[model samples]
Target: MKLRERLEGKRMLLTGVTGFVGEALLHRILRDLPDTHVVALVRRKGSLSGRSRMEQVLNKPIFEQVRERYAGDLSALLDARVTVLEGDLSDVPALPNDLDIVIHCAGDVSFDPPINQAFQTNVLGTEQLLRRILDSGSNAHYVHVSTAYVSGRRRGAIPEGPVEHDADWRTEAHWGLAMRDRIEETSRAPGVLAKLRRAAERDHLRAGPITSAQDTERRRKEWVDKKLVEAGGERARSLGWTDVYTFTKALGERVVEEVGAPLPVTIMRPSIIESALETPFPGWIEGFKMAEPLILAYGRGELPEFPASPDSQCDVVPVDHVVNATLAAASVLPEPGTPAYFQVTSGARNPLIFARLFDLIREYFDKNPFDMGERGAVRLPIWRFPGGERVERTLVLGERAHKAADFLVTHAPRGDRVRKLARELDQQQRRLDFLRRYHDLYRAYLETELVFTDDNTWALFHGLDPEDQREFSFDITTFDWHYYLVELHCPAVTESMRKYDVIRRRRGRSAPQVAKQLPQGEGIVAAFDMDGTLLSSNVVETYLWLRMPELDGQGRAREVGALLRRMPGFLNAERKDRGRFLRAVYRRYAGADFQELERLVDDSLSQHVLERVSAAALRRVREHRAAGHRTVLITGAIRPLTRPLEPLFDEIIAADLAIDDRGRCTGFLTRPPLVGEARAAWLRRFALQNDFDLAKSYAYADSHSDLPMLRAVGRPVAVSPDVTLWREARKGRWPVEDWKTSSSVSRLTLPGANGGSSS
Candidate 1:
């Protein structure tokens, strides 16, 4: 049963030879029937018209295997006997002469198809191809790919044969297509004539005319819908098809059944086909227009609370099975006058219930966890199920948010959003500039997902005899859905991510000369936000920072002691997450002097930031100096408390310090202590005046409050970030790192002044 023996040197023409099903079939045809010349439909070489579509299908891994299997270039075989007619399917199907088999798999597959396109390809285009077979004067097998749902109104127990047509109901969807064509034609016609007529009116607002062509093909829209109802919902239920795709597919079936004569023909009805488990290479699929959304929702962890009866049937099959079945059907094609029908499905006969499918998914996830990016391998506590009503409530809340924003814009923060967006845009531009300046060392984060189905496909080849099935047994009954869903899907993501990483790393290596090293010298103080940027730790409630002084008027409840004193009630209150309690416990009203704070900082250094950094980050600090960058620590931890960090850098800048009469503390800052705008602007001015280039600087920070400092620097990275910081970083396209273990000193801290600290 060699391929050369099967085709007997005859030529085969295929319309969607580059498509998912077609590509696999093309491979099968060429592999099993080597002597069979493949006349694949390819667009003109230099045409920009369908490049995206063409490249996506033709450049598949299967096609590569086809070329390799032939032991030479596919182009050579094509040039010799496999003719590639370059033309659009919508145009008349001008096919090659003298073909043995004509497998048509091209055209629209989406349920909600844009109009004019459905008939052009699915119905009329198919009709044109069949005519091409007749016109070429060659007896070819018309292997038309029709949907299983073309059964129209047939309910249960679909027979494995052509739907018996009643004498009265012969012409099915042709009437609708004719009606729709006119509507489509009128919709595209010149509305300018009407506009011109209006302009020529006796007494109108005569400033020429105002028109941009919007004419409703109302009669057409209504006609098609009525026709869909008449034609039945087989197309709807089977393919989840809308009026456009279903009626047209129904039309395709009727047209072929009526007109496909004087030639051998077989219509294949493929149900929901999914990823290949064992046949060919695993997980081979093209654009997932149908199954993609579900996959995307799953990947995003949004499908955890979906609406589906656990007991509902979920039939799926691998694509290779369909290819095998199609081939077998082709091999045993009945002579002209007799048409064969193969319902390649895994419906109730071999049910794969929703519960079983979900269990498989859960099992897959349990064994092979999906990468959560920066979130780490998460056994994320399942979010509380918010029903459909809750989702509506969220939508309502969204409206409320919009209203609040509108009110705020009208009242206080007038144009604040505009200003904020502009500032953000400017910052993003600077980051891009930096990345481009050092192209080799920078990268843009690129992400993509994989989705597919294969049920009728597995049964496609299974329709053949036992020996044939053995050779091409692509059934899914024995498929390990869990392993496939987990392993098959995750690899695609991981491999794509790995490739993306490689591309980005290569890009990052192209970083500008200045990006390689920070500016050196003692005078060049590159001040950085301690929490996220320079040092890694939460400035707010990090376990270490929580031990800092209370800073109440007395200052007696110092550091850990103060925390311990308030911990019992605050812990209870904090669990409720109220604003007032948090504010009272966190914000320092009466502050400490620079000197006294420094003393406390040095004394309690180990309890504060010092114990946080790992050995690796400490090494990075040394590397920073060796690279000639003058590092300085900057924080919002009140005054002299920041002084303990001085020894690790050239200088330290904290919230301004003030002292009263004789070495006692002052409640308020000495000057209008820099924060937000004042902080970043001051740093920028200092860098400019001190010959330090903001364009060549780098800063890191943890909290959202320190975002200004991070954004001001050329390279602003985040470490152990808060939600706000993480989102802003993404929007701003900033780098992020989280070295928060004992092995890495990324967030190092020095001892505090005395036995207390203010972090």
Candidate 2:
């Protein structure tokens, strides 16, 4: 009989039906091999019954063709031909014993999942399934779906066969046990307990001061879990695997060999599976898979750079190709002995290089850039693939820059320009760190020259009759990379992204009037610093020195006296470590009612500070506002102080104190204070979001602390004369206008003055 004829009337037990490949395979079998009965394993999810989940799975777009052929009555079709087994591979529940074929497709696929969770789903789960099949005395031909990368870091032509090194199952078991023991031991260790205590203290300051024994245990467990994940990554890298998923999947393959030795077994190793080429529907994908996230990130101008070598051969195969190869392998099994291995990969024949893939992505997105609503279109960033070595160098540079920035931000004055640069540098450093870690995880694969050989796969296909070959053709050589990627893959990925809100497609004219009028381009915004430029006295210091005493009513004298005594120490701290001092001062207000604090700050600002607003500085602000430019109050001052001045500016960006559910101050900021280079970063984001023209915008400040914000705009003006500001403004040839009552109305025209319009 032919391959389809052989599969007809056969009872096949399929695992991971909800997975990408499994869903495709299920569709193929049900659609083509009409007589075959399938037994699918589905685990119960929260609130949803197992059968209900399976039903939902069948309704997915992957099964669109199947649904259409059956007129959307998937339940009726499944009821007649498939058995929804409601249990997980981790469980010891009874499996469908009376089976002709068993396809194990379920395995952990997460790049960096929790260590124990990866082990349980990928390794232990496979072992349990194998045990269930063997112990039931079922004469099923087991077809285990694994990955070609399970060969790990082997170079050159990786053959379609068993893994290179012999798996030590006992050693793996012992290591797992030791890891479990370590987890339990470290969760209660003194060092861990101390870390928990520090974390608890921070939590108390942020939220309410409440911590239970259970809360402490939860924190301890979280720490242990994080450590376990780190250990798993380290272990996987040491053993030549990319991540826990691959490492554990390799272990699962070993277990399958040991446990299913007596049964007829076939191991089908497929490469990176993309969307379906010619099955189900063209470009049918579920969630984002493989390198799609990177693709999306690049298209949206969010990705920094591609770290891999552009010329590296991406060993990718269509999902349908793998499914066909899998069914073909199962149909004609080898003599009852060691498991038959067939690599279903595309590298040997239809190899698509990373450079080519990236080109296709660029080509697709170039035509259709992602829209960010009123923020305008994301400018397609320069596509940089500096390769591995340059990426490492970039990472090192970023780290150094970050360290320097951190030090400056900590030691520099509260509202200094150096602090803003530091914060911006710090953000760059974080992105670099993330990229470095990502590079480390996948560096081996990118560097590897491995081309997975599919000799066995081709031989199996050649053994079949012409009719059978035509029925289930998995010829890797026939795959057209350009057609598959450009015409189908890229478009499909973009469509899916839009569906999931990963990209916001431009809405039609029917969109809301408010959204339409949000402004998009060529509009200017003027950012003004409050403390030194607009106000004569520092708002934060003034609040502490004068207003805070009023808030303490009866203890006014004691509190004011205490603040005065601490003033010298705070000043010393300001010169030494400003960040720490800022945090310390904020911590004093923890647990204070937010509403009461707001009222006090409002009273203080209007009564004492607002009258002190410089006349010249106010003129500059009014000029920008009168010119229909967006006026922004960018300050290092507290939000409550800025609130009273909100009417003067269209947007107020400042340090906001964290408030808990009870409307009490949490002694911490809701986010990092927008000061220093951070202010500049915020402006850039604000300009993007509000469609402002930063190049045409203006900035006015008294202190050199507003350097970043000033540098960001086209017209940067020094409002008042501070020694540092005067010197820097003179050196850089930036406009200088003293806003003091002494020089009010008369603007200082320096040597380079060409009698330009001041505003």
Candidate 3:
């Protein structure tokens, strides 16, 4: 009989209903095999109950076509045709006695899961389920879902058959016991515990005080969990598996073969599963999968290089095809002695070369660019798919260059070009780090040159009548790679990424909204230093240099010559007291109209400083504003220099020059300049006069002279500090930021000399 006819009115148990392939199978069964009753196993996520989780999964866009089919009667259909089983696989005691089919799809898919976790869930879990089936005496046709990567690092054509016992092979139970023993040994090792303790303490020191015992205990647990995951990755590589997920999955298949010896069993191994091609609905994917990250990163121009063989096949199959092949395998009941196997992959039929896939990806992202707001649109990066060894060598050289650039930026003469070069190198380093991570995680898989044989899958397809063949279509020979990737896969992946970005941005913190009423003296204050903290360079010096050419035509030639002659004296005064030098520097504008100088400062600020505003400082100002704090710009420079930033601040405080009745500038200060201790004293007086809480205020500065003011505030931040101030900030453990450059320039890079071509 046909599969659907036999499936009608049969009791089938399905695991992993919330996963990608499982959801597709569930939808297919409900829509086509209408009479099949499905008992689905679902795990509770946090506060969500099993039934609630199932409802959420069904409501996902992947099941949208099924929902449309049933219309308002969807709930009625699900309630009648589906049964929810709550709890994990290992917790279950026995299978339903009336179960005619058992499709085990639930397994951990984490690439770097804990060693014990992968084995327990994938291998032992399968053994438990099979034992339960045997104990209950249910004559169920079991279908175990596995991955094509279980072929491991093998080359040449992999056959669709049983995983035979070789010289190194052991029984599944023994293998599980050995892995469990290793996990226990690693967990309780003295060196491991000591490492965890030291790492936790370092993390706490980097953050703040870890006062509570519960907090320390939590950190210890987190460290242990991280260690376990690392160990799992190591073990997988040593065992010739691509990852912990695939390694344990291979063992799971072995378990099924061993335990289901007398039962009718079939194992289906599918390749890299993408969205559904023809069934359920097109362009339906649940979340970001293996290849989507590389795709999105390349689209955003983040990942420019990767290590992969250009000639190798990608071996991708749609979820619907995998599901169809799975059902087909289950229908063909195996003999009592031997189990059947099917490789549900497209590599052998419709092979897609890596070069072709890369071209399609580039074409798709080129036509539709990812928007990145003010920074500009994201341009797609060039794909450098040289051999793995060549890519590794290039990355090493790139890392060395990043380090050299870092040292040069620190020690070279300080200027815009220097800072820009530093920023560029830092960005390159971050990209390199990302590439390195990708290489480490996926190197084995990407380097694989094997093609899986889907002989059994095709055999099952041809065995079905033409009508059944069309109904349950697992035939991948007719699949089109370019159309599927460009029209369906890429667009679907991009839409999912954009939707996620929208949700994240909405939930993220935003800039402070403008309040209708201006803040008063009673509110909290966030004082910011004006010069290097906000502007990229010193405003006083830059403004003076900018006005030098204009001063050539004025009657100030003699005075300018006199000032230049006394430059050494001015420099000496600056060494003794910065306040005095600042006070005397205003004499350059002595005879000029005060209003004209103000206009000059304003014009110069608009032309030079506005675009050079530090992004980090702007973000912090917005954060403080969002928190309802009054932002104040505090500087020793005159008010005209800081007036352009007034809109971003609640108040501006600066040194004032004595003006004559005719608005002409006098070459003297009205009061002592606000510098060093004077600035701290002013803050104290301002807080007292306004009835503000000193302990709740914040201050940001870049110079060591502003140490007094920083120490007076409750939260002190050091922004783009000089050498002395950076040292002091480190001593006090103050939060320091490089506001002169973008955050992209601050990303971590592997150590190397900056002497190579740009990546």
CA lDDT, every prediction?
0.54, 0.73, 0.74
- Clashes (candidate 1): 61
Across 212-275, the per-residue lDDT of candidate 1 in tens digits comes to 1111233335545544433333333343333456557767776676678778888887766666
Candidate 2, run of 10 with poorest lDDT: 750-759
Question: On a 0 to 100 scale, what is the lDDT of residue 437 in model 3?
Answer: 75
User: Could you list the CA RMSD of all candidates, in the order they appear?
Assistant: 16.0, 13.5, 12.5
Q: Highest lDDT among the candidates is held by which one?
A: 3
Give candidate 1 regions above 4 Å deviation.
Answer: 1-4, 45-60, 65-74, 152-154, 164-243, 377-467, 476-480, 483-759
Please provide, for model 2 over 628-724, each residue's C-alpha lDDT reduced to its tens digit, 9 standing for 90 to 100.
8888898767677776687788888777889999998898988776655567778999999988888878787775545667778876777653444
Q: Which stretches of candidate 3 lie over 4 Å from their true place?
A: 68-75, 165-227, 371-379, 399-430, 498-759
Residue-level lDDT of model 3, residues 405-521, one tens digit each, is 676665554444654565576567778887887887777778788999988888889998788888789899776887899899899889977887667667552322223342443
Residue pairs clashing in model 2 are 416-705, 417-705, 420-676, 420-677, 420-678, 421-677
TM-score: the better of candidates 1 and 2: 2
TM-score top scorer: 2
